[model samples]
Target: MHTKKVIIVAQLFISGMMALFMSGVMSVIHMGFTAQWFAQWGPNFLTAWPIAFVASMVVGPIGFAMARIVLRVEDAV
Candidate 1:
């Protein structure tokens, strides 16, 4: 939890889970879950996780700002 807000926590969870599952499926699709599946997936997941986490951190606030303006929503606690 640390000092993370609700928004940040939600963003992390959503982005992380999405990336994990998507990468898993995509890796399997590319390699058919063969003997090399984890071997391949490890590298791919390692590459994707950081990018996804950083992207989520960067994009979440921007998207939230846009939504607030567009929908005239009050900032939530």
Candidate 2:
């Protein structure tokens, strides 16, 4: 029942935050928290954000459907 605009806005915010956190975590895991981490993370996050945005748009509906099915099954138990 959510409107398309609301869904898109939610996806934008969620993907932005997710990309920010995951990019930092993965970069640090790969290179540690070096002084160069900021420089490295900048481009890395930039690359990831768009991909994350598009991917979320693609998978969001499927994920919602799966969650609904799982929750329904759980409630039936």
Candidate 3:
């Protein structure tokens, strides 16, 4: 039980960190030093940050939940 909890917690943390990194990458690509170059590519570049951030927010929890489920199944076998 304790091990399961630790695994779940670790998975959640990893998923959150991955989500944050993806969001940050989008932010940097859209608003950082490359902003001018990205703008030249298309207007949609301005919208990528928010989209990636929101997607990450949704994906992280879902990923964590899935990881927990998989861990539980593995423990059962």
lDDT winner among the candidates?
Answer: 2
State the displacement of the C-alpha of residue 65, model 2, in Å, after optimal TM-score superposition: 0.6
lDDT of 3 by residue, 1-77 (tens): 44656755665565556555655566567678575644543444334545655665577558767998987755343
lDDT of each: 0.80, 0.91, 0.58
TM-score of 1: 0.66
Candidate 2, number of clashes: 0
RMSD of each: 3.3, 3.9, 7.9
Lowest-scoring 10 consecutive residues by lDDT in candidate 3?
40-49
Pairs with steric clashes in candidate 2: none
Which candidate leads in TM-score? 2
Scored by lDDT, model 1 comes in at 0.80
Which ten contiguous residues of candidate 1 have the minimum total lDDT?
1-10
Ranking by lDDT: 2, 1, 3
Predict model 3's lDDT versus the native: 0.58
Write the number of the candidate with greater TM-score, choosing between 1 and 3.
Answer: 1
* TM-score of each candidate structure, all chains considered together: 0.66, 0.88, 0.37
